[model samples]
Target: MDRSANLVSFEKIRKAAALIKGAVLETPCLPAPRLSQLTGADVFVKYENMQVTGAFKERGALVKLDSLGDDEKKRGVIAVSAGNHAQGVAYHAGRLGIPATIVMPVLTPFVKISATRGYGAEVVLAGNTLAEAKAEADRLAEENNLVWVHPYDDVHVIHGQGTVAMEMLAAQPDLDVLVVPIGGGGLIAGMVTAAKAINPNVEVIGVETTLYPGMWGAFYGKEVRCEGATIAEGIAVRDIGEITTEVVKKAVDDVLLVSESSIERAINAYLTLQRTIAEGAGAAGLAALLTDPDRFAGKRVGLVLCGGNIDPRLLSKIVVRELARDGKLVSIRIDTPDRPGTLGEIATVIGDMQGNVVDVEHHRLFLNVPAKGATLDVSFEAFDRPHGERIVAALRDRGFVVRYLEIGDRMD
Candidate 1:
């Protein structure tokens, strides 16, 4: 395949489909009715989250490894990744009985590193950022005579990733728009190749985090730096892939960026509305969809939920932040007389307002209140913002001074 044209042609994608059969999951494309309602579009979600190892990278890793000659395989493999790619290479290499060494940055999430090691691959924790880690991997691969696998640059990897578009179009042939996340551009470039082959009319849009616009810079031939922290860590490539840069430039319609807040909210929304768990990168496609719902309105659009290997601690934080966003959780303090019935009075007002009290504490020593007065801190889950306001109104109406606690300076 003369890939200089930057196309992973239908023929190549089909071959990849056959090559990776039984090696990876044929992740399902499901109807996203809730997302459709939110966007006024016929939305379908490609659940790559269900892929083996809980991500789509397995497809590319397996395909790439499968292409290696016996000597290359004997020499083993080395790769640099934040998480998903590391696990993909480790799992597939272990399955092939090929020794694997994965180099990941120190800041890489513990869950990802653990999962990669659990796949029977040696993990080297080196460097502080992905770029630094990748440099270390290159040096080690040279030293060990191992075949270094470029996560997004290799043709076999791109071919494997192309299968996603094949599945999407097969599951829903009339899909008018295909929204995919753009990190190093392996996924989107491959998707664009297969999608354009199947249906030229289908608009293939690449979604990216505002923090890292690698693909965007490549598409426009601009020297933009990809920096800043983003929730979509899966696609936080500081540099775009060389091969994928060409592919995306030729095939992708336009690259779109979404704020970290939007990405976080999309992750939460997918859990709440679609009943699906999406890692930061997995949620970027849907984030773009939500950002410009009207652009896809009334059309059949497909978005890929690319991965779901989020850490438990991060998940807990997202849940709490979402609850705060919905106005369901609130904190407040009240000045009350030091009498025991004063606590009962506030509790009665909250109970009467049908708010579920989550916690309450009385402070007498740290407040500016008189010796006869106390400060009561209360936490509750209200039905909505109005319900929370109503409870505050009820307290004020009863002559008890009440003030809502500030939940930090989070704008969203």
Candidate 2:
């Protein structure tokens, strides 16, 4: 299937590049040495997160808005999105003097809701899911005579997203593969169309969270269940777009599914190793690489860091969780006599071992603990796994009953 002929064409994408040239940033595509070392692939990251709205959605949003007729623009536009697309349309529409209305799920993060409103778009919190939100957007669009600017599934939007690939190829024409995240499939579809047209030899792979394999399920003709509270909420789509599914069927070489843990690790890697912030969906491409290094080893791989609008609190939790996974943070429980010196001895041992105590809890009411005995739950920061182990071993040598605590361990 020649998707370029029937769906979005290379020529149209080129025009979109010209139309949105100055409106959207041409984010840098730079080599990432640390990521390359970690993934065993010569990695280059297209920093789409560096855009003014901190995502690549602005490119497509501006193109779609610009294509509207004067009368249509006057009537304003309506769109349904989780967050990134909402901000994209809201920001660009405001700049173009076009009133925009965004319908977002009620459960959307407060940060995104506030950001969309800040961009001058009237935000309507509707539905528990994107599908439900779209229904409300459709009804509102018809009632108010507003122009419907789809987040994906439109030719202009697809063409606009293709500009990302055009820029990527222009920067590194010899890239062996392009790893992109998939939601409603607009980004990957456009990227596949442009990348394949520019360099047929370059493989284009799409990534989706395991919780929402909308594109993957569509491409493979399987009834994969799609529902979960994924940290990558930007890509947690249950339904793939009709236009995008067609493009994926014809052009996308493969689609990969990554787990929540892998996504968290990838986000942490971007912050600690690359010195950058990558939202959950943004880190999915790198998560694929981490999932299967051998597939891309020794090849020149390009990853689109598509968005960086993650909630600060979520990002902090992911960072701390990763630290605990790496043994840099640890929690331990010690059973000792309910005496003052018992706590002091444990603290002294931890301090003497160069561990920093983060928190401590005293439990005396536990039925299992003797009346004179108490349980001390201590959370501490350690240099590494070995260092933590040495501390635990030292505590044991002092005749204290010690137990290491895993994440999600319940006290009861």
Candidate 3:
């Protein structure tokens, strides 16, 4: 596919805005006061999380469904998504009285699959991965004579998703920087199109997980072969859309790849500090800001919080990981003589260091320790890394051999 400049004119985006006016909610643009303080940038979050389907996908899905003729609608629609798009298509199809069948990867979030099913769509669990699910969806569309509603490739869908930027700029035209999360390039493509049309001076940037830098490949002409697990799975497309790649190449200013840890931290921060539930992809724009605060410092920036459909179990895991990342949780292994009060002695040291022991496991028979020595793994939470280290050193100074299992960085 040619990565040339293919802009959806401002007129088309305006038409899309008109077409989707009463159908989609005009989500709020919230002030990010805490984030602004952290990054030295006046940050405002475009809260698409509160959209009817809990994602910006509703905008594009509704537009695409409305534009379809009666024949198309009667034929029903087939869509493949890991999560957000499936819900969007299913929800709008139900509202429009059109039959829809959605194909989802088996690995998709439980919340997303359940939401899509609740929207009155026949759900098909196709494959373990999204790419395979998409192949199955394409085959089903052909076999069942269903109209395919692509998540991000079509021109109509591009126009539909651009409405986010339209409403965003309308709410705050002075936004100097726009940070968007990329999946298959649809959302950011639409955003850049509308944003550049309104204010060409605005810096339109894209954010992706380092594990799945699809947009990075489309922009920088890389091989486009990132494949791994990411918290922001909603934006983890391996392939870039043809139209979207062109629009992005012409209009997008920069594409930054962020770490999974950054995404997890952003999700936790939004949940705890902002009192918002943003899914991995939804928190991605904020992750970019946190990754390189210096780039956006003092600028009035706009971010698209793309979606909010996450499984409860996954959310719990993210919270736990975030705590560990922030040094609040530490797990350590200690070798001690199998004598009385050995465990009590370690507990006393941890308490003295102001660390609260959360859990402990002792290994006697499993280890190769002598009859007099045993292995103990203790987990605790502390105020920070320094406090946790103090507890470790205190135990060492007291003639105990201790090693912190969680002290090493994953970077190694």
Runs in model 2 lying further than 4 Å from the true structure: 1-5, 408-410
Runs off by more than 4 Å, candidate 1: 1-7, 367-372, 408-412
- For every model shown, what is its TM-score relative to the native structure? 0.94, 0.97, 0.93
What is the Cα-based lDDT of residue 412 in candidate 2? 86
The lDDT leader among the candidates is 2
| Worst ten in a row by lDDT for model 3 | 403-412
lDDT of 3 at 391: 83
lDDT of the candidates, in the order given? 0.87, 0.93, 0.87
> TM-score: which candidate is best?
2
Query: How should the candidates be ordered by TM-score, best one leading?
Result: 2, 1, 3
Location of the lowest summed lDDT over 10 successive residues in candidate 2: 1-10
- lDDT per residue (tens digit) for residues 1-412 in model 2: 4343375888889999999988889999999999999999999999999998889998999999989999999999999999999999999999999999999999898888999999999999999899999999999998999998888888889999999999999999999999999999899889999999999999999999999998898889888998879999999898878888899888899999999999999999999999999999999999999999999999999999999999999999999999999999999989888887888889899999999999898999979878988998899999999999999999999999999998556568
Kindly report which residue pairs in candidate 3 clash with one another.
40-298
Candidate 2: residue pairs that collide: none
How accurate locally is residue 117 in candidate 1, as Cα lDDT from 0 to 100? 98
Tens-place lDDT per residue, model 3, 243-344, is: 888888877999999898889888998888788899999999999989999999899999898998888888988887777777889988888899899999
Q: Relative to the unseen true structure, what is the C-alpha lDDT of residue 248 in candidate 1, on a scale of 0 to 100?
A: 83
